[model samples]
Target: MKKTMFAVLAGMLAMGAAQAQTLSTNAADTAPHFYMGTGIGVVKDSVSGDRDRTWKIFGGYEFDQNWGLEAGYSHLGKTGFYVPGTTDYTAAHIKSSSVYAAAKYKYALSERTSVYGKLGLSHGEYRYSSSAPGWNFKESNNGVYAAVGVDAKLTERVSLYAEYERNGKRAWNGPENRIFGAGVKFGF
Candidate 1:
């Protein structure tokens, strides 16, 4: 009876060890090492209350499941306006773009879903131009940026996410910009 009991206990231990190993391997397989994504949204200008189409592309490297670093470029779109005292004849536009880097933190809600946030710095360029002479201007600004989003995995290497971001001020004396967008991430 003692030998039979010992044999059963040993078998249980072996099975538990095997299951643990399998779980570990599965976790490693799902952890993203590198990823890239692209998204499109509308940028709301805080100064003018205008909405314009915006788009971004980004790549990231995960240090582990919960922490990573990301970098991206965004075209924040163009806004057109009428030159003062010449509303019918003179039109000018402002175009904005930025490059940014951020540290990301993610929290898992399930095996297939997570929520994440990013905080970083961005360098922005804004160009104001018109057919009318003396209306051309260029400026650059640097400021902090932030974003929050949810990610849902469709497969081991592919996922989708929706995000809201503040792209920062266009210039020292210009407007703040915000975006809401969704995109797909490909992991490698």
Candidate 2:
């Protein structure tokens, strides 16, 4: 009877330990590491269109089942002529750089794949270049962004992802800029 009781107690202890949860990106080889991405955007007005590209590089820390934190840098720029056959136009070659902190939620579709969404705030500077002589404009602002992404873990420490985000850049003219991008991530 004593031997049987000892065996039952051992089984209970093992079950208790098994029921305890363990979480960490490192625990799953099919976990995300880092990401880099960009977006193609078009800004339009009654007389002109400003087309440009925006990009970002970010890293995430997976603390548990459905939550993470992300931080990254992004930039968007555009330059060209507008209002064809007109000299009285502005050249809004605007470039912006910002750092953002975001909270993420993800759903796993498979051992190697997952889709996630994030929302965050960023502070950045805008450098606006104009075609008019001595007419450069510069300022800074705080903005918010929402993004969606999918990641494929290729290894225990590496993952690749494609993501898109809205970058709000309002030009002096009548055009506004947005951003999108895709890139790889590495985690420790």
Candidate 3:
């Protein structure tokens, strides 16, 4: 009886140590050092006639558990509007594209979830076209951009996220472009 009890106690101690080592190794392996993702969503302009489709591709590097840097390119789709009560019917369309770099901050709510915010500088170009007067205009400008979102880890190397972002204003005093979207991120 003494021999049997001694053997069982030793086995339990060895098992506990092995479990601790595995947990530490898993923690190191699950940290996200780099990640990339692409998202497609609806873009709405305050002055435009309707909401349009928007898409973006982004990549980032996490320097630590709480902070990172990101860069992305986005296409804000075209919006069309018609002038009413006109002798000749005419429509105007506006389209835009942007590139931006931002700093990201994350607040972990649990082991699998976090909330984040971003602020950045954006450079974009807008094109306007009208059929009535045969007018076409193009303009480029730089502006400030911002976003807030949440992320939920789905696996060791993948996460799912949803965000609300303001890419930037089209011009100094022009309309702002906004987007709401969800996407998956792959980490390395």
Each model's lDDT comes to 0.75, 0.57, 0.72
Query: Residue 106 of candidate 1: its Cα lDDT?
Result: 92
* Residue range 1-188, candidate 3, lDDT tens digits: 33543453344334434443443324633365998998876765656445567888999998877889999988877665665565676876767788899999998655556679999998888887886664478888888889987776656567767777887665532235677766778888
RMSD of each: 14.2, 15.3, 14.0
Q: What lDDT tens digits, residue by residue, belong to model 2 across residues 66-168? A: 7888887765544444433447775545566666888989886555566789888876676766667655777776778677766656554565565556544
Better of 2 and 3 by TM-score: 3
Model 3 earns a TM-score of 0.75
The estimated TM-scores of all candidates read 0.79, 0.64, 0.75
lDDT tens readout by residue for model 1, 1-188? 33543453344334434443434234653466999999876776655776667889999999888999999999888776677766567987888898899999998655566779999998899898988878799988788889987776666667777777887665533345677777788888
Task: Answer with 1 or 2, whichever has the higher lDDT.
Answer: 1
Residue 7 CA displacement from its true place in model 1, Å: 56
Which residue pairs show collisions in model 1? Answer: none
- Provide the clash count, candidate 2: 10
Per TM-score, the best of the predicted structures is 1
Quick one: RMSD of model 1? 14.2
How does model 1 fare in lDDT? 0.75
